[model samples]
Target chain A: MKVLVADDEPQIRRALKVGLERHGYKVVEAADGEEALDVFAEQSPNVVILDLAMPRLDGLGVCRELRGWSQVPIIILSVRGRDDDKIGALDLGADDYLTKPFSIEELLARMRAVLRRVEAGQASEPTAVTVGELTIDFARRTVTRGGTELHLTPLEFDILRYLALNPDRVLTHRQLLTRVWGDEYAEDSHTLRVHISNLRAKIEPDPMRPRYLRTEPRVGYRFLSGRS
Target chain B: MPTTRCVYSYAVALAGVAAMTAALAALESVRHIANDSMLYLLVVIGVAVRYGSGPSVAASIASFLAFDWFFVQPHHGFTVSDPAEWLALVLFLCTAITVGQLTAMLRSRAEEAGQREMEAAALAEASWSVASQLDLDHALRVVLDRVVQISGAGDATLLGEKAGAHQVLAQVGDALDPAEHGLLVLPLGAGERIGYLVLRLPPGRELSMAERRAVNSLALHAGVVLERDRLMRVEAQTQALHEADRLKTALLSMVSHDFRSPLAAIKASAGSLMAPGEPLDEDTQSELLSGIITAVDRLNRMVENVLALSRLEAGAWRPMVEPTPVEEVVASALEPLSAESSARVEVSLEPGLGEVPVDPVQMAQVLYNLVENALRYSPPRAPVEVRAWRGYGSFVFEVADRGPGLPLGSETHLFEPFWRGPGLGESARAGVGLGLALCRGLVEAHGGEITALRRQGGGTVFRVELRREVGR
Candidate 1:
């Protein structure tokens, strides 16, 4: 796999290049957003790791330009306390985000997750999906946990089905609401919270420390497929 | 000078003399009354009290001629027959003139006193408005209203001049065109004109001499008010700049001491590994690497704390409140700690303590900073306790540590930024002393309270109480 790293900081780019190269992945580099686009078109990398702040054009601008014609997975790198910028990048069709000061291992996990999501989108939907001990049978519209059938309301079942299908990708409140409850209910996050809380109670062994459905706080929710 | 008023007063005096003469003639024909001419004094006194000295002098001379012509021995003429009668007539004329002049003098003095009283009342109202109202435009509007009432102007405006441009500060009634001719413009201030009080009066009307004096004094009062407002603003700006300077000095000293130590440690560790001496053993090499990592972590934490403090002080961050489970808040707080440090913490929570309306991100940050502080100060092998419960319609939590207790009388100072406890040795873990201050700012922003108290059996407990329902 080839990864394109774009950042204004020379030290960060050098560190990431050295780290990702040791993992046996081909790495391409760009010092700013405008160059990142040129390099991306030339190299056609499989994954792009973009920083939010850069010279000439920002990561959001690059994300918007790339999304206009391509579906290549893009992960955003942002500093902490910049939640609005992160959400804006996500809304503009970026795949995922990682706050800065993250470990190399954390960045690798996010990269793997976004790559898996892109691969899954190209393939046909699976009838049955299993993560940990929980099994979701899309064909039969049934969910079973630890070999015992768990009863779920139809609305709850639809919410779980939508999240389970998108496995490791983060689904914002607008995305989930429009898909499960229709576009008219896209802004009603409070209702989504109530149902998700109820669903977590029935699915997870420990609702306090969720293993599958995780909150992104002020952003949205993500379904961890117990992969990374 | 209004000639119409002077003419009207003389006409009234003429009418009074005619009426009195007719009355005296009728009385003389009915019965020969002694000293009938003395009755003409009534008309003189009436005119004097009503019309002042101008018309009363005319009435006194007119009354003397009428009495001689109609009631004296020489009828219809100013001639007297007997010498004694002539002396009596002369005495009567002298008495009428003296009484008329005295009554007119008293009346004029009374009118002057009333005019002064009215001017004083208006001035007192203007001064009160200027002193009480802090809003310059509003106060000036009140002053302009009084100017209109006293000067009888159709409209009034207070105009401030700056760099040869006139700007209307306050206006009462219709807006005035500054370019209009014949406006009663009064320059304000004692020596140099700072502004102009422009009054537009009704066509063909002008202010009385007394009204003009009152208006000028009012304009001066407005000038003084404008000067006072400018001085107050300058004083406030100076105070703000002084406070900012003090904070900057504190931050500089803190950065020099706290930031240097971690940088020095990192440099030493990295330098030793890079030295071209004998190759170090594996254990020593790993130790140096770990040392570098530890120093980097310390520097990162310090940077985060400083950034958070500045953001809080600048009011750039506000809690994005939502309904969140307390359990989720606790989990996120513990997620950042190392496994070994996490093992040292013992958690206890009230059963079924459900969700709360709060900014989960900020609340988690508050708890994390408190726990980290507790873990750092705790003695080796001593368990730090984290407890949460709902009480008194509020959600309360505390982090307790079996470490050195707080110094006496330093409870309040503990939460102030850059305040470090005394007697901490070099071996003790050092922090930039911003964690607790950031916690206080976040908690208070949530409409909550945070406090630190000495725990029993030699430790300190930091407690946070948050409102269960935050207002949107």
Candidate 2:
């Protein structure tokens, strides 16, 4: 994946460039706002990492300017470490954020997840797909297991729709809560786990050995189609 | 026709002349009664015209006798020839003078009383309408107007100084046109020309000394009003400054409180990572672990400084003074220092160190700052010492180290915020110099003094002195 990284400090810029390149990304670097904009225009990077504070122009200013012309996925990296800065960058149309002194493992995982979502958004032409004895139709709001019709609540249908879109991947408890109940429910892991268990009972033939719903131990829950 | 004094004097002069003329006439015109009465009537008529008739009756009776003696038809005789003439002359002369005297006296008294009433009403109207305003500027304006109305001086002002400039606060009677006329200002402040008191000329009149005195009092009263208003303005300005200071303190406290959450999270995570177990890679592992511990300590110190600064700015700090043992302060300082101090910090107490009256928390803060400062300047693995000694009736606590001492002639700038060391170009540990400032503030608040000293042996020493407890 081609990625663009922007930061003012030389040390931070070097560390991020080395780490991202090791993770198999074609890394491009910019020292400030003018350079970042110039590199983005020339290279058309798949993902962009922006530092919130820079010498010539700030991250929010760049985010706003870039959003005016492009829909590329952007992640803001910052030392400000404040929720207001995070929310400001996100509201300016950037997709995600990571605070400073962060480890490489977390950065790689977040980068892949955002890239996968962006790829899927472009690949889709139509909504419904049927697999095995189970039939799913997003337009008609219907689901079947072993050719038997399964009743699902309105909230359960939304959860199933998000999982079916991802197909097979791990989703942290925080992400699942935010995707389902909302950002305020990000801390309520008990509520998310209970709902996930109830969903498995309805869809899986044997709920004990989940076919579609999978748990990544303490991390979170995942909807597994077993295709990937 | 005449004033009361002039008319009274005229009456007396004419009466004396008439009395002489009457006695001479009584003697000489005893036989000329009819002629005398006619002459008396003529004199009284003249008196009535000149003296408003009150003195006319007496003059007329006296002059009539002279007329009888000098020009009566029967000469040098006591009896009248005709009884009819005798009765007519006496009744006509007496009755005419009495009527003239009575009418003139009533007119004179009534006019004097009416003039007194008009003066009273004019004074009342000026006092009520002009003295009604209590506002300093408005009152001064009205005071000038009232002075002019009461004392009849034209164009007045109440003058004073403000911000090193002369100001005429209240000048409403007449615009005085000070630029046109070279009107001089009077300061009223210790007899120097602080400001002006202006007045213009009134047409066709000169001010009496009494009237001038009354005008001076009006200016004096204006001065009193101006002084009161200046005090009020000063009070309002002070209140606004206080409110601004209070708002700054409140904002600081709110921001500091919000920052603690993140610091708590970082500290907890770092501490857990340093726990002793389930780890490999022993090459310089101790140093990496030390890095985590140092980060936690720095975070903790930052949090503490923020909280203390917020409290200090908010005016929430109240010094609670008590007789505190010097040992307790040393123990408290050592407890925190030992946790992070790489070298063993040894504490020494001189014998007979007495209890010092001070706020315990603030005293501990002073000791803590001193200990930290000593540790920063000292070499790695060098021993640092805390000593408490009583000298000259005051308790002195000091921290001394064994390393390269402070730069010579650098005392003045060392305590400033964000200063760096000259010797060390770069180091893992760095500071913004908030510690010594806090130390100074805490020590001074408890009526104590603290200073840094260049140790003769080596390194630096920070000494703090608290007032010795008296009367148990």
Candidate 3:
């Protein structure tokens, strides 16, 4: 994955470039707002990391400029961890943001998430399906293992269908609740986890070490298919 | 020679009187040989004109003797032969004396009246000096000057009471030590002195009566001016205090409103985020973070604006003005926010535009705030324009965007603190608006003005104008 980091402070730019590149993404750097624009135009990076403060241009200005022509996923790095800024950036078309002094692990995770969403939009076919110790029929919603039938609840079926629909994509707990249980249940991570545990118990050969459903710590859960 | 000349003039007068008496005696001798009245009446009129009232009585008695000897009955014998002639002689002498004295008194009274008229004219001309000057200080100076001219004192100073102590207010010529110039204090009570008069220590024994009266009059007039001036000052101070009180009330309400809105948003957003699940997808998690950052940015700008106000009051910060480039300024202000917003920012500096004279750091701050303000208002899908151009000998940097135009009347009040417009309050993602106020301060520090204009079709434009630094 290609990522762009825009920051006026060389230290922050250098640090983010090192951290993001260490996560196996190709990194391009801009020292100031002017260079950030030039670099963005040249590189067409898959993901852009920006600082709110910069010399030639600010992160907000850069965000605004990029949003005009492109719907590319953008992540803002802000020291100001206020709701207004988040809303401002999101409303302006930024994909996500990371406040300064963030853990490198979190940055890598967000980077992964945005790329997955971008990649998901262009994906064409449903790849594969598996249940218990058997292959499944995706079009007809049936699963068998060892030549025996497996019973799945209607709610469980719906959850499996969503997971399969967004295979290898990290879905935050809130996203999962909203998509599956509706908007009112978006905040109920406990409910989401219980449902996920139940789904794993029914579908996984070893529920403790699930192969399909992966837990992304401190952020969300992801569904990784056999292709990975 | 002096004795002969005195005698000759008196002798000439005596000769004319004696001749008149002889002629009257001849006429009376023809008409009535015993009448002496005509001769006596002639002598009385002559004495009134010649000697005045006191000397005139002596002249009248002498004339009576002349008449008895020359013009009475039994001429040239000093006796009137008839009893009727003797009675006439005595009556004529008494009437002559009284008439002479009355005529002399009237002439002298007319002369005394003329002298009094001259004194009134001199006094009127002197007091004219006081009436012409209106300023209290000027008037007092004129009064003192007139006193010096009128009373012939060599020098003058007007001393006034301020807070119950005397201070020399206005002086003309050889300013005197309070102790040196023999001062006459007349404190203006209902009937007392509230002021003092100083006069030159004239090389003389003591003050004349006229000098004392002139000093007393000056003190009375000065007290009127001093009291009037004091009253006017008190009234001015009261008016200023009332205006300050009004401003304070306005400030308090605005501060309350400004602080409450963003704080509410922050609290509400935090409350929402506290729930266990990420209600918004991975994308929405990012959205929530962006909102929080925006709110915090608003709060920071507000705090900076308030701090700037306090600093202005205490004179803690004074701008060190110099020439600065617009492009550089834009970069410095935006550098931090670009990363924070995660948005693309566009910056274009007008070519051939000269540097503006301003404090470099403050100019940067001004640019930062305007860009930030525009960013908050504009859509993230739109490119925020930070454009600098030269117009009419002034350099202007404008942060323009395709956002909702400023609310009615808000274009003018936009730079006022806490002025969240209808456009801002309408936004679910709005912030407390102190950014514009801080921009105003930074611009004004460089002797320029900042204005927010609603663009013709759509969008808000913040225009900052600065005078170009000369010869650069």
Winning candidate number (lDDT): 1
Give me the chain B TM-score of candidate 1: 0.74
Alpha-carbon runs more than 4 Å astray in model 3: A1-228, B1-182, B186-197, B200-243, B261-297, B310-319, B340-344, B422-432, B441-446, B468-472
lDDT of each: 0.85, 0.65, 0.66
Which residue runs of candidate 1 sit more than 4 Å off their true CA positions? A133-163, A173-208, B1-134, B152-168, B171-228, B278-291, B318-332, B338-358, B380-383, B389-395, B425-428, B466-472
Residues B1-472 of candidate 2: C-alpha lDDT, one tens digit per residue: 2366666856673775466565656666456343334444445555665566557666656555544554455855545677876776578666756755765676556645654454445444434534575456666566667666755555676667878976666675665544655553334434544455677656545555445545555555566566667778899789868865764564354334433444555566566567788764665465555655556556556556655654554456656666655554554455445444823677778865645677655677778788777777777778788888887877788888876777777664565433455764433334334577577767767777887788888788878887785332
The C-alpha TM-scores of every prediction are 0.80, 0.34, 0.41
Local accuracy of candidate 1 as per-residue lDDT tens digits, B36-133: 77777788888888988878888888888888787777787778888898888789879988988999999878877777777788789988888889
State the lDDT at A195 in candidate 1. Answer: 86
Candidate 3 or 1, higher DockQ: 1
Candidate 1, A1-228: lDDT as tens digits:
999999999999999999999988799999999999999999999999999999999999999999999889898999877888888898888988888777788888888888787888889999999998999999999999999999999999998998888777788888889889999998888788778878887998866457788888767888889897
On TM-score, the candidate that comes out on top is 1
Interface RMSD of 1: 2.6
State in Å the error of residue A218, model 2.
Answer: 27
User: Comparing 1 and 3 by TM-score, which wins?
Assistant: 1
For candidate 1, list the clashing residue pairs, or say none: none
Best by DockQ: 1
| Tens digit per residue, CA lDDT, model 3, B1-472 | 2455445545544664577676776786678644445555555566556545655665566677787776655767786799987787788777877787786677566644553443344345435644665567776776676567655667667777778787787776766666763544344434544566676645543444555555556556666667767787999789868855654664676556666677787777777777776465676666776777677766665666666654543445556664544433554466456454525466677665545666655676777777766776787667777788888878888888778777778777777655555645534345435566667866776678899888877998889887765332
